[model samples]
Target: MAGGGGITPIESGIIEYAIFIVLLPMLAFPIILFLGHIFNGNQTWVKSA
Candidate 1:
């Protein structure tokens, strides 16, 4: 990629976008999991005797 007054390395650009692509799921997973539990009404699968 080209920048003002300089050239940006292609590898660096790819890695920068890759960081967001990889990071988004990593950050969202925990948030989604917690939200699911809260919305799930605290139910468990196993039947209690």
Candidate 2:
């Protein structure tokens, strides 16, 4: 409600949508790490000059 900018949760369903939006990144994060590990396979960081 603090950041809703006067929009009510019942009117916009912002609370539900906010949970989904927040969880999306959280869910994607694990999948991203898994995919990266599979593709990169413990690759080490490169050094720069």
Candidate 3:
């Protein structure tokens, strides 16, 4: 009975960690791209004459 209870929390933790790992890269990519552009300064802005 005690062993069964242990499985429940462990299973829950695995699911949560899997979700965090999957979501982190989705969030990280955009932030990295934005920072790269800001730091690199290669892009041009146009102004009207």
On lDDT, the candidate that comes out on top is 1
Better of 1 and 3 by lDDT: 1
Candidate 1 at residue 47, lDDT? 52
Cα lDDT, all candidates: 0.78, 0.75, 0.77
lDDT of 1 by residue, 1-49 (tens): 7558654698678877987888899999999999888767544754546
lDDT at 31, model 3: 100
lDDT by residue (1-49, candidate 2, tens digit) is 3574677659687666778888899999999999788767444554445
Clashing pairs in 3: none
Candidate scoring better on lDDT of 1 and 2: 1
Per-residue error for 31 in candidate 2, Å, reads 0.3
Best by TM-score: 3
Positional deviation of residue 3's Cα in model 1 after best superposition, in angstroms: 17
State each model's C-alpha RMSD to the native: 6.9, 7.5, 6.6
Candidate 2: regions farther than 4 A off? 1-10, 41-49
After superposing candidate 3, which stretches have Cα over 4 Å from the reference?
A: 1-6, 41-49
Q: Considering summed lDDT, which 10 consecutive residues are worst modelled in model 1?
A: 40-49
TM-score of each: 0.50, 0.51, 0.59
Which residue pairs clash in candidate 1?
Answer: none
